[model samples]
Every structure is written in C-alpha cells, then in structure tokens.
Target: MKTGVLLVNLGTPTAPTAKAVKSFLSQFLHDHRVVDVPRMLWCPLLHGVILPFRSPKVARLYQSVWWPEGSPLMVISRRQQAALSEALDRAGIRMPVALGMSYGEPSMATAWEELKAAGVGRVIILPLYPQYSVSTTASVFDSWARLMKKERLVPAFRFIHDYHDHSGYIQALADSVRAHWELHGRGELLLLSYHGIPQRYQDEGDPYGLQCHRTSELVAAQLGLERHQWRTTFQSRFGREPWLQPYTDGTMQALPGEGIKRLDVICPAFSADCLETLEEIAEQNRSLFLAAGGESYHYIAALNDSPGHIQLLMDLVCRELA
Candidate 1:
C-alpha cells in the first residue's frame, strides 16, 4: 500500500514586507479557532485597524529574524521535512514526506497533491505542534477537512494529536540542554516557555497549557532539574485579553530583580526555530531580561531537524503506520 506523510506547521509570510505580512496575518487571524470574536466585530477591527497599523511593524519583526533563504520558520520546516524523509529511509520505510502550512505557501492542497501524485493510498497528518491547541492543531484539522470535503477519492488518513510527554521528545530536549550547558556552562535558571493562548480557550477546555506543563515537567525530570532550578512560562500572547500567564515578558523582567541573574530559556512548543523563538525570545526577551538587571541570558535553539528530533518524528510515523 502506498503511504505518505504530511508535516504541517503554522505558516509564514512569503516575504518580509507589510503587503505580505498583511496577507499572512489576514488569513491567520481570521481563523475562528484563532480569534473567537464574532466576524461582525472582528473583521473590521482586524482589517481596518490591526492589519493597517500592525503589519508594517510585524513585517520588521519578520525581517529581523528572516534567513537569507526565507523565513526562519519555513526554512527550518523544510529542513525538518527533508530530515524526516531521510530518517524514514534509514528505517527502511519508503514514503513521500511533504510540508503544508496552515495559512500560506506550500499549502495543504499543494502537499496533498504531492502525496496523491505519489499514488499514496494512506496519509498521516503530523502537525508540528507537539503540544496541541485549538488555535494551532485544530486549525490544521479544519484545513484538512475543507480539503477533503471536495475530494471524491479521499485517502485513508490518521492524525497524531499531541505528543507532549513523548519519551524520545523529552530526551531530545534534555540532550539539547546538556549540550548547551556543556558549551556555555549552566545558567542559574532554566525556563521552559511555550506559546500562549487566550485564557478563555483554556477555560473552554483546551489542553495546550496543561500539555506544555507536562512537556516541561518531563524534560525537567529527564535532566534531573530541581524545582528551583527550572520554571515554565508562556509567550507570544496577542491582544489585550488575558492569556495563560506567567507571561514570558513579565517573568523575564521580574526574574533578575528577584535575584535570578542568569537564565536559560527554551521554547518547547515550537519544534522549529521561528519568529517567536528566534526574535521574540532570543533578541527581544534577552534585551528585556538584561534591562531588568539580568547579567546572563541564553535562548536555547529549538529541536529543528536535529538527528534526535528526526528519529522522534520517524518513530511517530512508524508507530502510526504499525
């Protein structure tokens, strides 16, 4: 039976420009899973106010972290796709692995077409988000549903929901931390930061925050980290509405004054380094922490395309195939 894998990630702008960012954000923010506000109020506010004023500023943020080849997210995601394919080959599995972005280029339709063209009779949807949220994972599901509804010959498919406490994933995270400590020595505090969703979402039964805590706890256990040695926080909150807190910015700003002078931060929610991990945590938060009296700040890179991470992905696919 022909089988294939569809690796999906939150999308990125095609270019670091207001025009492009606006287009990207329009589709991303408009998703009901993302912004639960009624379209009557949300559409005008999103287009007339937010995008008009925010896109240029956001475009600059994208530019700051943009790789020469493309956005960091897209570049890292592509590398991950290639690495996963190689890992599957090593495991004696021949399958086409294609990438789909939830909102933009290399879209779901394109990825689905690639697999269909390969004569795949079965497809596995592997969303890159390890800790699932309606905003991320569900959005991918919504896109898939839309795609399949128009298909007369939809392939048999399965979706991997969340792997927050996957043993290999925790080990890979722990290994990365150890390697970083080996090079730069250990920081006084290790912060596991994940992207934040609105508090209402959690109240509405989203498991994202809970899974993030589980991921952090598992990694901390794997690394033999004491309670005081590590912490968990949330980042990339949008709008004025409350989000899952210990807001990363506020925590970073307060930590130094609380006598935590040196810190190491890692974003586990992101499988690949992107705007949030690269610019927001590494550059912006680093500066914020330093300004607030932090003496040392280190942002650990994500597990993007690492050998261990590839192995983990391959294991996930193999498990599903079995």
Candidate 2:
C-alpha cells in the first residue's frame, strides 16, 4: 500500500524581527486550546495589547537563539525528516516523508498536498510532542481536519498521539543522557525539565504532566539513579496564572543556594531544541544558576536527529504502518 509519513512540530519565526514574531505569536496565542480564555475577552487582549508589547521582547529572545541556518527548531526538524526518510529507505519502506510546522512555514496544508501529489493512499501524522495535550496534539489534528474538508479525495489517516512510554523513545533519551555524561562527567544532580502548561489544563484532565513525570521516572530508573539524584520540573510559564511546578528557572536559581553546585538539565518533552530549550533553558536559565552561586551548569541537548532518535521515530512510524 502507498503510504506517506508527516512529521509536525510547534514551529518558529521566519526571522527574529518584531513583524515576524508578531505574526508567529498571533497564530500561536490565538489558538483556543492555547490561551483557553473566551474569545470575546481574549481576542482584543491578544492583538491589541500582548502582540504590541510582547512581540519585540519575544523577538529578542528568538534573536538570541537564531542560527545561521535559521531557527534551531526548524533546522533540527528538517534534519529529523531527512534522517527518518533515510531510515525508512534502509528498511525498504519507500514512503514520502514530509515535515510540517503547526504554526509557521511548511504548514499542514502544504504537507498534505505533497502527500496527495506523491499518490499516497494512506497518511500517518506524527507530532513531535512526546506527551499529548489538547493544545499541541489536538491542534495538529484540528489543522488536518480543516485540510481534509476541502480535499477531493481523503486518504486513510492515522495519528501517533504520544510515544512517551515507548521503549525505543525512552532508550533514545537515556542514550542521549549517557552520551552527555560520558563526555562531560555526571553532574551533581540531573534535572528533567518539561514545558509547563496552565494548572487549569491539568485540572481539566490533561495527561501531559503525568506523562512527563512518567518519562522522567523511566529515564531515571534506566540510569539507575536515586530519587534525590534526579527530579522533574516545568518551564515556559506565561501570565499570572499558576502552571505546573516546580518551575525550571526557580529550581535552577534555588539549587545553588541549596548546595547543589553542579547540574545537568534536559528537556525530554521537546523532540528538538527550540527557543525554549536553547535560549530559555541553556542560556537564560544557565546564567540564572551561575549568578546565583552555581559552580557548574550543563544543558543536555535534546534528541535531535540523533541515530537513536531516528530509530525510535522509525519504529513508531513502522508500527503505525503495520
């Protein structure tokens, strides 16, 4: 059977400019699943106030992590696509692999069209998020649904919602951590940090937080680390609302004072390093730790285009195809 694989990510700005950031934020924050406030109260607040005031600051954050190739998220995501395609070819799966960004360039519509043009009869969508959330996974599905509505012929479809508990995925994460420690030596403590969502989301039955903790525990167990040796935290909170805690920045800032001199941080929730992992965790949070009396701070890179990660992704795709 003819099959196509579509990989989607959260996306990044085309450029580190106010205009570009504004456009990116406009799409990102406007999603009802993201903001969750009633449109009557949220729409004006988003475009009128938040975009104007926050765009330039957010643009600066993007500038800090912007690479010669482009946003790290897009760059690594493209590399992942290439790696997965190569793996599939080696496995004798001749399928078209396309990358889509849920909120920016290489959009869902374009990816779907490419699959259609390639004469695919079945399409499998794999969002890069390891833990499922309505804001992330469901949003991807919503985009696909919209695209399918106008299609002359809708292909058979399947979605890989979350692979947090996948053995290959957990092994890939453990491998990355081990590789990092092998080169730099183990830190005084290892911090598993995932992106935070509003407490309201979890209260409303989001499984994201629970799955993140499960991934952390599984990875820690694989490393044979004690409970106190590693812990999980959340980051990237916005607004005055409560979010999943202990917050990553707060933990980093407090660790040094608590006599934890050296630390290693990893964001397993992200399949690829983006502005959140690069600028926020590696740069900003690193500085926060160092300035607050930390002797050494290391940021473990995300599993982006790594051999193990590619294999894990291929395993997930093949399982879905089978």
Candidate 3:
C-alpha cells in the first residue's frame, strides 16, 4: 500500500479578528476532549459568556503576534510541512506528506483528502505535540477516526502518540538552546515551559504531565544544565481550573524575588511558535518578569523548520517507514 504522512497541529484563527477568533474558539472549546465539562452546563457559559467576552480579547492578542504571512503557527507549520517533504525527497524516500490543523482550514479531513488524491492508502499521523494529552493528540486521532467513519475504503493507519523523550528530539531541543545561548548569552536560569492541561486530567491517569517533565529532564541533561540551572513549568492554561503547577506566569513573577535576575524561557511543548509562545511567553511573561524585578529575559524560539528540527522529523518518518 502507498504510504503518506499527516502533520497535525492545534489550529489558529483564520484572521486576527473577533469574528474569526470566536469561530475558532467555538469549534476548539466545544470539543469534548478539550473542555470535558458537561455540554448542558458548558454550552450556555461558553456561548453566552466566554465566547462573547474572550473572543475580542484573544483576537487582540492574536493581532499582537500576527505575521504578514499569517499567524505564526500557521506559517511555521507550513514551513515544517514543506521542509519535511524536501527532507524525505533528499533521503530518496517516496511519500506524500500533508499538513492538517485540528480545528481550522486545511483541516484533518482535508489533509486526508490530499493524501488520498496523491494515491496514498496507508497513513502515518504524526501530531506535532511532543507530549500526548487526550485533549490534544487524542483529538487528532478522533479527527482521523471521523474521517475513516465517512470513507467507504478506510485507510490503513500508523499513529505516533508522542515523542517527548526521543533522542533526536531531545538533541534538537538542546542544540536550539545552545545556539540561542551562544548568540544571546546564557541566562542564570533556563525555564522550560510547556502548555498545561487541567490537574484533573493528570489525576485521571493522563501521562502528559509525566511525559512533559521527562522531556524537560532529557533536554536539560542534553544541554548539560545542572539542577539549579534549569526548571520546568507549565503555561497557557484556560478555565481557572488547577493546571499542572509551577505555572509559568507565576514562576516568572517569583523568580526575581529569588534573585534570579537573568532568565531564559522556552516552550518545548509547541513545535512552532504561536501566540502562546510568541506573545504570551516572549512579550507578556517577559514584561511580567521584568516588572517583578527580573532582568535579561529572553524567549528562545521553537524548533520550527530549523535544520535540527527538520532532521528530527526526517528521522521519525524514516524510522516509521523502515
């Protein structure tokens, strides 16, 4: 059977506007995996309160980080898709790879359509999330499942659940950090911040929290960072529920008091820099840390289409095909 790859990511708003943000959020938040609150209780609150109020504010945030090409996430994801395809070509591998967003244009179904049109019969779904959460990776699986449900000829599939501790991934992350430190000077503390899911999710036996810490430990070790030099935290939490602790924002505020004046932050959870990493970590969190008496804040960019990252993707694909 002819094989193909699908690179999946959580999506972005089509435009940096209130209407677009609302539409994106409505589909995103409405997902059962994301917001497990009972639909009966959540529906009214989501539509009547959150969407109405959050959309404009979130749209403004998106606007702050919007690129001329598109939202950073969309643009960088496309670059990744292209880079991986080229890498496969250079490796003499024959496979069609397509980009899919879980919630927006070029959606997961559309990606499948592209691969199918390319004469693919077996699919490899590689979600961009390094740490698997039902809220994220499983949601991508659900998209594939839905597409399969609609098809008369169901495609054969191989799914990658996560790659949080892959050697290549860890090496790529460490290299990115080393390069950043070389250019900008290493900070006193290296903060590896990942996106947080609700505490309850971990409590319910999700391995995401554990996988995130493992990824942090592996990358930090690869960078030769000592215990005191690096720490892991979580960010981009929603809905006021207790999220994985040592929240990035709170830690940023507290680090200055601990006399950690110089700090560097990186969001390894994101394959590509998005509003969360770019606007939230780079801009807002940096301001917060500085305002609270810190100095020399730097946000290391994500491994988006970088050579090391592209190599990591190439390795994963080759290994799977082998």
Better of 1 and 3 by lDDT: 1
Provide TM-scores for the models.
Answer: 0.99, 0.98, 0.99
- Give the count of colliding residue pairs in each prediction: 0, 0, 0
lDDT of 2: 0.93
By lDDT, the best candidate is: 1
lDDT of each: 0.94, 0.93, 0.93
Expressed as tens digits, the lDDT of each residue in 132-206 for candidate 1 is: 999999999999999999999888999999888999899999999999999998999999999999999999999
- Candidate 3: which pairs clash? none
Which stretches of model 1 miss by more than 4 angstroms?
none
Error of 3 at 30 (Å): 0.5
Instruction: Report the C-alpha displacement of residue 184, candidate 2, in angstroms.
Output: 0.7
lDDT of 2 at 25: 94
Clashing pairs in 2: none
How well is each residue in 29-75 modelled by candidate 2, as lDDT tens digits? 98888888999999998889999999999999999889999989989
